[model samples]
Target: MSYKLSRRKFGQLALAGTVVSGLSYLTNRALAETPSLNIVGIGSTPIITTDQTTIPEVNTTELDSTAPDSVSTDIKPVGLVLQSLITGKAQVLADKSTPLLELNEIVSGFTSLSDGTLVVAITPITTSRRQATPTRITFLGTPVKTLIVSGLKQNQQLGSLLGTNDGRLIGLVGKKNGTPPIRLVDIDLQTGEISSISKVKFPNDERVSNLAECPDGKLYTSLVGLNGDTTLVQLDSNQKKPIRLGQLKVNGQAWNNGLQSLVCSATGQLLAFGAMRYETPNAVYSVDKNSGNMTRLQDFDTTQITRARG
Candidate 1:
């Protein structure tokens, strides 16, 4: 989804890629105070690491997720991705029947503000390709509506995007003719305003494949492998050059390099990427963020697992 600027923030230049790359619906009024949420994990498809950040659908065949609490906000999943070809506009699919959140083209992506208030990115009415504005809902509960902004404009079209603990900044991608395919944006997390620190692009940055941010707000972009390593570079705001590392890929795509993901801890632990074959059931490993050591998170087949976009 895209975000807002009072000038009409056309978003989704906000949606589309990391280079690229879900479902459940259950609505209940006053679900806010409900004790336990009824959730299901219908399917767990392994989305292989690609050049883009992939948001997997939360398949709900049957699950028992914690219901809406005071802090619990229900954002119905609408599976969507932008096409590189751009012939047709990107589409979102609400595969479920009655969802908690009702989004029209007027809406892009949504994230929760830690405070009680809802801050959103809105798409300006002037957006040519899409209809929705990237705005935030006042309350995700009964009578859901958008929180208003003062003097918001159209340049804000690349509306507010939610972030993951892993450091994926979910906002719009703004592109111009001959420019790099994607532009990284920072969301204010409040008021839904776009930051002057708005766009980020790398040299020869073709399409952003997969991106992961560390707990420290440092971001790592996953690129198709070149040379000896499946690469993920660390960007330094002060320095022009990035710190580079070589990740080992167990998946077949690493024929040229290794499959990679990066993680960092505030306490100074540094965990680089490593993978083993997942025989059908995948084994997860946690790298020592500070030491670069590997520890197991879950056990699965590195071999049974698949390789993806180089």
Candidate 2:
């Protein structure tokens, strides 16, 4: 549905911060008003920061009224999916792969707060001649406050944001230029500052894909090897090293394609979106936290989704 604010409301939003143009302000409000458990995903698209005036308004379409029992009764269906394309617009998907809203900036990762508000990690576009820009931590609620994250180097970017049960915001910071060690960090929501927690040392040729926090407060990560072998690892809260869980198995065999996104539902079920091979159709899988075995839940289109949070 189209969301247009009155001129008075527009003035208020403009004064608060750089207002996100178009229906995003009202669309976000609509999402906030309705309370439901949603699984959010973001696509991998390079975005560069530009003048606000040059950005176009966000495009939106009517949402599907029927929320189908697509995935399963126990788990929530994929609700909001954000994809950044070459057009510099972010598309939101609801039930089908249909686009609902088009945003100006690229959303790399997002997590929900205790109050159901969303904390999003946005990476601004970088030009070939310029160094990478700092990722912005945006709180999507009433005022839509945004903060430039500090303590990240020029070649580093934060993804896989997870809001812990105790209210701590954690993220995985990875290097852009080379395969440097990926570090887990605590992000200060108020100050947009980050402090190192521990470096995730993967086995030779293994790289981390995403991170998730379960209801019981345990953290998990999906690692991909050079041969496309996928492994699930657990990060103990008090320990510096990660414990290797098994390879993510499907039908008693290792899932060849890596899991692009990992999220733990409120019901304590681990879920992920991955394919059997690269550039194939994606499917939702219920992951066994203990054994890393996966059961297929639903299938999706060939659209490339990079990260997920529930």
Residues 39-128 of candidate 1 have per-residue lDDT tens digits of 111111223345676444332112123422112223333322211110112233222221222233233333332222222333334446
Q: Considering every candidate listed, which one attains the maximal TM-score?
A: 2
Off by over 4 Å in 1: 1-130, 133-179, 196-200, 209-218, 225-230, 251-296, 299-310
Task: Encode model 2's per-residue lDDT on 61-94: one tens digit a residue.
Answer: 1122242211111111112333211111224322
RMSD values for the candidates in order, in angstroms, are 16.5, 12.9
Candidate 1 Cα lDDT to native: 0.32
lDDT of 2 at 211: 76
**Stretch of 10 with least lDDT, candidate 2:** 69-78
Best by lDDT: 2
Q: Which 10-residue window in model 1 sums to the lowest lDDT?
A: 301-310
List the candidates' TM-scores in order: 0.38, 0.65
Model 2 scores a C-alpha lDDT of 0.56
